[model samples]
Target: MADDHGTSIERARQGRMTSEQIRRRMFDAALATTGTRGMTLGFPGLQMDDVIAAAGVSKSSVYRLWKSRDAFIGELLNEAAATFADQLSDDRALRTAIEIVASRPDLHATADGRRRLILELIRVVLEQNYYSTIDSAAWQSFLATSAALLADDGSESLRRVAETLRRGSDRFVEAMASFHEAMGRLLGFKLRDDFAGGFTLYAVLGSAIVEGLAVRHLSNPAVTDNFYLGPPTLTDEPTEWAPSAIGFLAIYDAFLVVDPDFDPRTIDAYLKELATATGADSVPPADA
Candidate 1:
């Protein structure tokens, strides 16, 4: 059987886009490449020839937009950062990042396909120093692309994103540590390091777990002492006690992409109540 990723990229050529359209096509190719290849050979080593081959674009055509392989790849990474900004209200980089994801041909390929692509994008952003290495022109292009994703979203959003991106490079290192720890816990493997590389680590961690999830990621991870971050542990079931589906409710409201009838404020209220009642820090564990 064809891997779901292969089928999707094969179908991307249906649209006969122009130079501008082809630029869009290249972004789609990047997403597809990551979806199929994973990170090791996927992110840093994805050469111009690979993109040209995958994008089915001539060298001349690709060159009209990017001067060299580094420029092309840098723009590609910027596009990803912009896509990631979508989940943040005041972030252009993030929104563009999402727009990039939403535009993927593989979006329709399979749920698993999309997830892998999203994860790959994150890994590249953080681990590969994808965003940091770009030149100013590419940075401008990245933000512009991100703005396109927002489509008339106010400028404030982009500024907010710049603020976030402006985070000290060192922060990325701490972030990488947290990411490795979290991934280690979830997957049953430990990262080779405690996430030592600073901004590169931030970009990687933020892209995969935080950026890919965008907002929906927090659905399960948002718990405070009372709020509920993970599965609730309960000890007694004398009467088969039931818990509220607070997490799902947020899924509905926060991501309108999910629920048509979602009401954000109500969901917030419910979360607040849950937090207060359970006491954020010491909710009884299972069997309590």
Candidate 2:
């Protein structure tokens, strides 16, 4: 009966596995399957069997950790929120430091140079938002999940999903504000108060517009060629995209600048830096 006793021991050991460990395994599986056709193509469409197969875990294990598909998605949204929070924290510090450097007299000796530096900082902030949203699979999935919830307006889940998305967007704005505040400290001016227009509105809308362009460009390269100002050959890589993006950002900023004396074109010099970052030909030639 030794073999039977060993089988009983094995069963008992399996039963004794910790819930946290099981959850971790299931969470990893869900993340692994995120970019696959089933996950990204549609939201809340993935079946229990799909997760079970992808996770390599038994149905009972998944049930124990997440009772249903909705429960699993809820957990995923929480994880995405936590991840974005960490990313925002890191970006806030880095952007602040960059703004401080940009504001330094020695680095930006001319008024034009300073203005350009500030504009570049704005692009960086937008890119940070882009990374947090489009570049992140978890965030994208969470967005899709939230959209699905909103579509089902009659459901009780809509409120929770809406709140989650609203909170996430609010945090994103607050993070952007921190960068603006840091820049303001250096320039001795507040963005919203000093700019004459609603800094908050422009900042939020500009970021959203840029993000939409990025997404559309990815989905259809032809859209960039037909609509954007520069060469129709614009690629999504930051290097190939510098000129058009910088020009667009300048146009957007023009409305935000209340001072008749303020000229958004001062940022032309900084656009070259974007080119340099993308390993493209810098404007005015690097040596000159």
In terms of TM-score, the best-performing candidate is 2
For 1-288, candidate 2 gives per-residue lDDT tens digits of 999998788657656768776666666666566653323423345566876666555668668777778877766655544443334333543433343343343434345445544555555454455444555554555445544554665644456556666777777666655545445444333344445545455556555665565566567756533422232211223333332345446644555332334433433344344344445443442122
Give the whole-model CA lDDT for all candidates, comma-separated.
Answer: 0.40, 0.51
Number of residue pairs clashing in candidate 2, backbone atoms closer than 3 angstroms, sequence gap of 3 or more or interchain: 0
Angstrom error at residue 288, model 1? 25
lDDT value for model 1 = 0.40
The lDDT of model 2 is 0.51
TM-score of 2: 0.59
Clash totals in order: 31, 0
Tens digit of per-residue lDDT, candidate 1, span 1-288: 578877666546533447787798788787566543222211565766777777776667788888877666656654555443332222222333333333343332343433343343333332222223222233333344444334434545344445444442234444444443332222122223333453344334344433333223225434211222332212112121111223222321232122223332232233234344434422222111
Clashing residue pairs found in predicted model 2: none
